[model samples]
Target chain A: MTTKDISRPVCILGLGLIGGSLLRDLHAAGHTVFGYNRSRSGARSAVTEGFDVSAELIPTLERAAEEDALIVLAVPMTAVEELLDDINTHAPTCGFTDVVSVKTAVYDAVKARGMQDRYVGSHPMAGTTESGWGASMTGLFKRAVWVITFDHLMDAEKVSAHWTGIWKDVCQMAAAVGSEVVPARVGPHDAAAARVSHLPHLLAETAAIVGDNGGALSLSLAASSFRDVTRVAGTEPGLVRAMCEGNADALLTALDEALAILQETRDHLATTPPSVEQLADNGYRSRLRYEARTGHGRSQESVSPMLTSSRPVLRMHPGQPNWDKQLIHAETLGARIEVF
Target chain B: MTTKDISRPVCILGLGLIGGSLLRDLHAAGHTVFGYNRSRSGARSAVTEGFDVSAELIPTLERAAEEDALIVLAVPMTAVEELLDDINTHAPTCGFTDVVSVKTAVYDAVKARGMQDRYVGSHPMAGTTESGWGASMTGLFKRAVWVITFDHLMDAEKVSAHWTGIWKDVCQMAAAVGSEVVPARVGPHDAAAARVSHLPHLLAETAAIVGDNGGALSLSLAASSFRDVTRVAGTEPGLVRAMCEGNADALLTALDEALAILQETRDHLATTPPSVEQLADNGYRSRLRYEARTGHGRSQESVSPMLTSSRPVLRMHPGQPNWDKQLIHAETLGARIEVF
Candidate 1:
């Protein structure tokens, strides 16, 4: 199938912040989009806001199957296993993707449900402290990294033409919403997420706990740096819990590595004229390296959106050898692909 | 002692970011102020910018002594010891305050130099990641917390009237520069700084080390939370070292507490369905509590520079019994004193 199926209607399985915002974005990008929310009140509110949303998942999945629409799982991590069963039963072989924080768990759930063939996983790296229907804004993903993962699959040669078409559809939606797709593999994505996302939440929680233990006086004196370090602590607890648990192995490793560094620093701090100079210097350089890698692309949002034009594009085809490896490498080098 | 003394001439040493910015704010607030920079290039640049800056330390201290101007030690922590001797010799009786990051360290050094009678200590809770003369701005201290520490003194009654007058002048500068004076005791101030400031730096630096160890692909996947958590790691290492080493005892305690939390979380993460819900929930609540404590005052910066008008004022005479204790309590309760 030489597919140009970005025009296909999309069905979203949850109408939380990510799902609700995605529905708005897909609609604005001229795609036929509808969503389902488990909360009846949330579904009703979205419907009242003039979006096509339903409280019932079965009918929504059936409609997606009928129209060959790509199903998007925008639900919580705890909801993914049960939702996969619903998808396998109702939507059958219809291709789908998710906006979940962790990738390997979703990959495992899809394999267990025998829906792996139709699954192209994604983790949209965009959000605010607020959550739910009211917090969802149309342009939330603008200039954000929409990470696309197909690395969990055994081989690119196993990805059928039909599945490739589905993956293309997902990339189209990502681009339409003004995000650059960074390709990552299943295991590595979660591992990376553990280091950069989940571990930070744990650290922030620990920081908050420590800050609070000092009572009101300590909290009162906390300045900008303390505020920044603990800012993620302000995020919804359910979200953090789901994200951390879903990627426990990688997160545990991350916690260990971070703890080792802290313990070393703590030991040195006990000596006369405390020695954290190396760590501090290395940390400063680490931040600079990250800044160099990401550049000012986030700050350089364009008024009009397009399908992967501005950034250097890496053209690739379906069934290429080590395609996942190539894509991840290309991503690290600041390259994007329109679709696989 | 009524502090019509806000008009008193001010002399500052070390034209680094904090000192340079303080000079601008003080001048703009209608105080007679001049600064000295050891780096001739820096002094020449400040002079070119129409600020009265000198390259010679002796002459500057002599002028401050002759005019009985309040001296501000805005030098790096390592340089602090050497400069104390200069202050003791050239401006023997001139009252002074410091903008050092740690209070107890400065308090100890001042006492050893026999300059305790003429010294007040402050940690201006305001900064940018950037340092140096060029990065300093006129309103950098606007709406910032000017933490005043007098608790290092053995007793409130022991504070001579002249020193009280000097403390008042410091508060006047804080208020004039649009900062809220939060009084803290010497020991408690360093302890609080450890929990909120120094400990967070260690955490952030550790985070940076962990993130970097993940290599380029992992760095590529990092997002906002990672950015926020490691933002403090971007600060100058020397500054961080001085602040941390100056308060190593408190910092070590904080580090131990944080590591315990991480280790506990890590141990649980190895179980069936990882249990981080308690930590997650507590962290979220802790953040909300801090927001409640700080309010939105930092964002609610007054267009017109203030001298203690917007917030409630707590009046107290210097040498009152437990005056430092009262000030810390008042600060926790959101009240600011005009002066000591």
Candidate 2:
């Protein structure tokens, strides 16, 4: 590919955990990266940590304007609208993406800025309890889902190619670090995350509240099990609150469903009193089924778009296993298998 | 202590995880340990793993009866009643203790045998998810709580002396291995454990149910947050089911309270949303308070019962710092530190 055809110098606005980590990963992968942060200290820290950081939004946007493609807005949802306004004024020529968890608001904001063709809503599902430049690691997005929103206004081929290239690089890194990177449509992705991610934080917070009221000594005795259940509760409260506020309806629905399930299980135990063996058996069978269907057992390279897509220009390397055969086998069998 | 005063060839009935680990720890502490398991293979494995294992329970009990003063029932709660009955008939003179999680039923059984004077109901708050003799480790009780239940029928001095000696040694070993051992009464201990331990398992089970219902692909996107929250859900479902069934009332109560609090938070978010900073501050404050109260922040040696209690003969080694200084200071400031 010509230099003009390649994606390079990917601009990332905001040098927080997600942004900083992405900048680090892309930079290490031989792409030039420029990071913008509202805080000068965050920018300084990102620079020290090997990112090309800029404090002023306009200057950073100017640098990004020179590049033909791929500017990622990695700031919080609350900041996205303001950031988009700035991006419209300064970096109007560049194709853009964002890592915002909540999409509808940011999507509307981007559309309002008349940048719908250039901007694709994205959310890379990866992070730790920690935040900021200090906690940023190069391998953060190694095996994480990088959801890209597709709409009617976008150039399908260019957008797909841009996302596919980034996805391929990220998938390789994820495999290297013993993780998985999957793709999904924006709505399903948000709903699923709200259920598994946002709702758990609420549950953890509830447990913490119980512990606080019951007595701290009782909370202290919380072993790995309690710690695991409520770990997300221990996250920065402000971020968690923001997440819940941003995705309130979906999160509330998930929480209600979860509470209902728990209540039903509790009621069942109270009345029917099923055998422990039966409950355990059900759990094992369910987990087994989940593992079977998810392609969790398959290697990352086997599912990459580069390996599975019908496009003829990207030829499979010599000695590379025929992933299509394994994919077909998996699809036929409706489960995972050894692909040798 | 004199050789006559020291218990020799202590009989540990049921060579499962607890029994096997105790055998290893007690043996390492220069105390003779004899083990018996219903499974011959388990006994053989224990012997192969360098434990003093015996295949026949009666012979092991008879041999221990001739030399030892103490017998520890390390079987499951279901097995404890039968073992206690057998011990009452076969080896009536031995001072007994148990390592069962629940205490009320076990206490009643011991009392029914008219052996309450000779029995100290104890539960070591430590273990792994793994079971069997092969899963045993030496430092299992290190820095782990060893709750001893006391009643009016028992001699306070003898019970205190016996437990003090055993727990001090175990506590010291726990500290050496970077573990903490706290002591508590049965009622409060079980209540607290239900909240911290049992409730989490139930919560995990509920999370797993959600995972199972959602498409498997959605479940695979289950990041570290989901995995952390649901890790204990993978525990032997039968065992967890039994635990929930056995401790149903307490667990249900805890679950109700937890759910109610979560519902309230959900409502708060849905109606009048709080600032993100306030939520984060609350979480941070709660965690800090929890750490401070639990002695989780204190050095292991400082928090040991050997240092906290006033029994001179039961004091920890001279080099160990006085951890009770905080307790003493709190007391001086009119804080009531209740000891049961």
> Which candidate number has the best DockQ?
1
The number of the candidate with the highest lDDT is: 1
Task: Report the lDDT tens digits of candidate 1 across residue range B222-340.
Answer: 77888899888888898898888888888888888988888888878888978898889989998877766666333333343353323446787766777667676675654567653
DockQ of each: 0.62, 0.35
Tens digits of per-residue lDDT for model 1 on A1-340? 1124484788999988999999988877667888899999999999998898999989999999998888999989889899888888898878899999988888888877667678899988888777998789999988677888765344534677777777777887897888877787778788888988889889998888898888766776778888899999989898898899888989889998888788888878888767888788988888777665555232332342342223456777645776666676675664566664
- Which runs of model 2 end up more than 4 angstroms from their true locations? A1-6, A151-179, A269-340, B1-8, B152-179, B272-284, B292-340
Show how many residue pairs clash in every candidate, following the order shown: 0, 11
Q: Write the per-residue lDDT of candidate 2 for residues A1-340, one digit (tens) a residue.
A: 1123233457788888888887776666666667789899988877776667889989889878876545778888888888888888887767777878777667778767667756656667688877888778878865454444444223332333444454333333333332333434455666777866777666666565555555644654555666567667667776786677787777767777777876666666667553344445655555544434433422433466233211111222212355334333322222212211
Q: What lDDT tens digits, residue by residue, belong to model 2 across residues B6-25?
A: 43346789877878888787
> iRMS for model 1?
1.8
Q: Report the number of the highest-TM-score candidate.
A: 1
